[model samples]
Target: MAGSDSLFGFGKGPPALLLFLAGMLISNIGRSAYFVCVTWIALTWSNSARLVTILLFTSTLAQFLTSGVSGYFADMVDRRRLSVSLDVVRALVVALTGCAIAAKIGIWVLFLSVALYSVVDRGYLTAMQSMIPALSRRRSAIAANSASYLVMQAGTFLGALLAGYLLHTLPYGIGLFPIAIIFATSAVTLSAARTELSDPTHANSIYSKPRFQLRFMYHLGRHRLIAPTLIYSLGFGVGFLFSSLLAAYVLDEMKGGAVLFGQMESAWAFGAVLACLLLISGAGKLLADFGLAPLLFLSGTGLILLWMIPGPITAATLLVALGVIYNASRILMDARVQQTVGITEIGRTKGAINTAATGTGLLAFTFIAVAGDTLAPSDIFAQYGLLVIAVAAGFLLPALRGRPRSHDEDRSA
Candidate 1:
């Protein structure tokens, strides 16, 4: 019954916990569509690889440098106000980006606006993540996280579809209408969530002393922080490489075009949605730590196989499997973080974790920049595969011996 309660998100928090989840799904739809439009427009407008790279790199770089600070603010501020304000900011930014495109604005303007949008996006996510524990008990937190990510992934797929439809059939400026509306809806929906998310310990103590205080350092060293951090870094970093290389893989290796590429993306996003669905089931607790190592190993094997897999149909099918494996790993790892940390520390813990993951992502991008020209897309996929397998190997021993102790356990020892 407890598991069932958690599965449905009927925890100790306000009823608006359900509202929070709904807002996540809705906003993500807009977020995903807006990014797709930005990327597509940038490529169409510039037709320059260097410019596109600069745009994307700016967004990633902003996250790498400031995720920690954003998380810090997420913790210190009233999370409800912080999150709702960020949602409004996002809506405004998305609308503004659309206007820039419609008006034929300077490329530099697009760059600056998207970079600012990028910063706000990361901060909004950190604030929302920190709110999960603030709204639920441990069991409920896991299920809620699973639910949260499920909708978010589904939103991504929906948004991609919306972008494709609008781009293919409608005028360019039409995209501005729906995105702004979606985010505004999200802001209104989430604002109704009543909860006290700020930590008094943080506000009152010397530990609250701005960024990188002694308090954060102490939590940074803990295993609770380390576990999720490593998992996120590997999953996100490798996943980003996959997204970047996938187009080339489709074009060159599979001899496919936009149609096949779209189909493959659908399959992958579908897999992620399916993963979250399974994770939110009655067996949610078992789902969090279950099969994580094996999932990574399987992901590596699939990536390696792509090095030789030849058919577009076959490639798309394989992506379905890989998507499930990769996203399940991400969702479960996120749940583990929520399980291990308390309301007060979850913000900074997540911030540090995201910083590490972004650093890993940037490193992956650097590797591509430096070596991408010489390597075939297949070769890059195999290299990423090897990295995943290596991470899996490291987890293999610990997984077999049984789940390692959390930081709290070490402290009690």
Candidate 2:
């Protein structure tokens, strides 16, 4: 797999990249599992859709405030070390929160834990994305992004499946501590891999001259990244429509419990894994041009379909389709950003994008939190779907990519 044209499509990918992606798998598994449990528990504790939305709103708010700074930090220091440290911190957060839950502490403890985890999660993710250019042996960043996200989607699928089983078999609080253990293991796994920067001078260039600019968001127009950034941000934002409300949709509308919720989540995750696998295999090249519109339209249609026909089977099937659409859009955006941004600026660029995405997510959470009492979860899902559909009708693909690089970019194709 370390050859010039490996299965990952990234020619000359280093062993460290393989190791890093392995670590990513472990970490995503933990993250997905932990959140699945947390959301279910939060709902069970409060028995209110409004409270669940508020809880998720707290996580998005935390990300909104710190994402830009986290981006800068990703470029300022050693990304590997920063990520390892953040993972340790996240492990502690999750562990303590688990203990708090076991002790029947107030909901504030859960909120505090999620908020802290949210901040660290942003930096951890940004650092991971920034590391791909350095780790992929100066080859196609799209290939590297696909490989990494492919691993991520697979891990989430497994984790959701695990969560589904655990939620049914295990005690509520017992599931949270295992996530801490998984994160801690990921930290150790990541620490074992070295950053194989082929061009150390340029790859490490961001440390010498750091970028802490907030106006980069406004100036994305100058570099011709704003269109893609805005479009992807919209795509990213609509995800909150799922994360914040899906559990409630399962419980209230589908009339299901934690096991059913987990099943739906796992189905969605498995579909995402398949999508990433398709992209990584270079079979999705034609899909690259179909752009975000198809993904958005598909998502909107799936959500609306779920609303129109509410059943456990329907939700699971529709979620699988929606998940594929969502991850395909994300893979496109990630590959686009990696192609456009140089290594030194990649961190800040991703940071800016994440901040904007989180802002939109925050708005979604707030809306659901405020209006949760009055609306069915499926109703909100349909509304959000329609909103994106309207946007989809007017939107085209962003000019995110320049001409393909003259190197190994399309080698697999």
Candidate 3:
């Protein structure tokens, strides 16, 4: 009975948790649906992988530009209102995009719409993460995060499947209507949730000094456990890179069509969803007990293995393995950060980490996009896997090094 509050450590079955999960599920569904539609359109129009990369690049650029400022606002404003507002903004953007597509707008309009959506989405995610500490007890934060992540994975899986099916059967413009409706519904659900926003003790004084924000980030990186954790999290970007290349990889390398690509995406997301469920059910503690370094190393190995497999069945199997290891490692690292950082500073700290990580991802994507003109996706994926393994090894060495003894102890002997 002790940990039985609403089945995921949400205290006493509050409406807020239900509302949050609903919003996350609907929002992810819309995002995935739109992504499938847009990517299909880009590929069809240009018939080139480079164009798809450029579209993804636009999204990464938007995240890079907005992450820092979004984090700042998330800490300063009421998170609940900010979350709802972002959803509303996204709904409007999606609706406008649908209209543009219906009227035979150019590809540039599509790119601009995606970029704008990414900016708002970055803010929405930061606000949502910031809300967790206020919504649950410290002991229950892991469960809360796991539950939310599970919903996200499930939504992505279903959304991709739905998008693939609908796109194959219906016209492109009509495919976007469902996505707009989903975004609007997400806004409505999030707006109905109740949350308490406590004023930060040092808000005015700290925020008044622009220099403090930079100093705060510097201090966070200097923390021993947190620093390593952040470094480990950089590997997460490689997973995104893989996703960006997946459609092209499936089409060009495997000679697969839209349906096969959707199945692959769904398979990866299903693996992640299973992992989240395991974590929420208390299996994460078992994995964390083995330490983050080993898990990361294994995840990198799994990614590397993905390139070696030839058949679709084998590749899909590797995707599932990679998804499990990748997401489990991420959840553990996130829980570590949440536990170490104070509640008030969580937004800023998470924002800084996300920005750095996204910036690194942007650079990687740019390199990959440029390289895509000549090199194959398999080669790019192989290089990314190697980079991840090397980074993991670098981090593992320091962690494995035993702590030094004090000089006074040796002198006593």
Candidate 4:
């Protein structure tokens, strides 16, 4: 089955695609596991919601700063090697953090590690996104993206379950060792990929020229669809706030322990998996037919429904719906952006979108840090839902006024 050409929309199941997916799977598992462990540790150490928010803020800030530069390099550099190097660096960082935990070091070390890791991880992600078009046939871009999301969601689900189990039964430092090992393995797996970095169609020819220019922004801004869609991407940050607050909600509102928190995380991942499956199985056509506004509205409605009812079971159910809508919308938008932009600008365009999204997340984290002391998690969840709704409504008018553009129209713009 693994060798089947029809599998994952690849004609011959290229080794590069297989290696890339394997590396992504392993690295995602490690990243997801470490995220849970880190969040729990922060909560236990400080017992302050604000501290947890600050931890999240540090990572987002790093990503926000690194994304633009990373995008530029993704276009100009050898992406495959850059990705492998990033995985190796992240492994070393995680190993050092594990050593710090063993030595009973301060929590600040973990914060610093996460911030550093976020910067490298952003670059790796930008490279990965930019490489997708080069890796597969043009006709299979959506399928490739859907397959990637499936692997990512699977990693998240398995990783959350494993982390919960380890944190519950093993020592803290021991739990981190798995993360380090997984990242190291990811680096090795990625080394097996046979990537063509010199594809003239994808490679920027003038590699020596300065990439940080205002003209790049002007090019992106001139596209009527790309600009609004990039701004609309901020809604993803608002939607993701649930992940940041999940541990708190499980501990405080649900009166549950680490195991329950992990279960909820896995549940969210399962929802995301279902969403990816839908996209892979042809629901992506709905996105192409209807455009993004309808999907965003549906996702906002799901969030509002989540807010209207407050309970562990209710939240879990609604999260499944939100995950479906949210991930589908995000993947669709990302694929659209990838399809619309020129190969030379793909990385920078994606980077700009990521920067905007992460910036929005920084703002949300600031809000949570300040207001967490007084407001209930449920209240915050509701307000975020409202924000999603407001953003969706704000975009609906433009979507209705303007007809959906063909691929030609998008490219011409």
For residues 14-71, could you state the per-residue lDDT of candidate 4 as single tens digits? Answer: 5666787888899889888988888888887887777888898899999988887888
lDDT (Cα, tens digit) per residue for candidate 3, span 1-413: 36445457565455666777788898889888888778877777777777888888888889877777777777777887888889888888888887887788888877998899989999998888777776666776667678778998889888889888867877777778788888889888888765533223255545434565555455355433444444445567756666578888888889998899888888788878887988998886677666555666676676667677766998788777777776776666667667766766777777776777777778778887788659777777777778777766765665467654222111110
TM-score of each: 0.85, 0.90, 0.90, 0.90
- State model 2's lDDT: 0.75
Instruction: Write model 1 residue lDDT over 1-413, tens digit each, in one string.
Output: 45533544646444565677788889888887776666655655665433444566677788877788887887788877788899999888878877776787677766887688889999999888777775566766556666778888888878767766666666666666688889899888788764544323355544456745324435556644565456556777656665556555665667664445556666777778877787677555555435455566777888888787767777777877877777777766666677766566677777777778888877777777667446776787788889888877776765467878444322211
The lDDT per prediction is: 0.70, 0.75, 0.73, 0.75
Model 3 residue 154 distance off true place after TM-score fit, in angstroms: 1.2
lDDT of 2 by residue, 168-284 (tens): 887767777788999999999888875542223243552325443665574355446665665566667656777778888888877888778888888888778877777766756
Which residue pairs show backbone clashes in model 4? none
TM-score of decoy 1: 0.85
Candidate 2 at 63: error in angstroms? 0.7
Off by over 4 Å in 2: 1-7, 11-14, 137-139, 195-212, 396-413
Error of 2 at 91 (Å): 0.8
- Pairs in steric clash, model 2: none
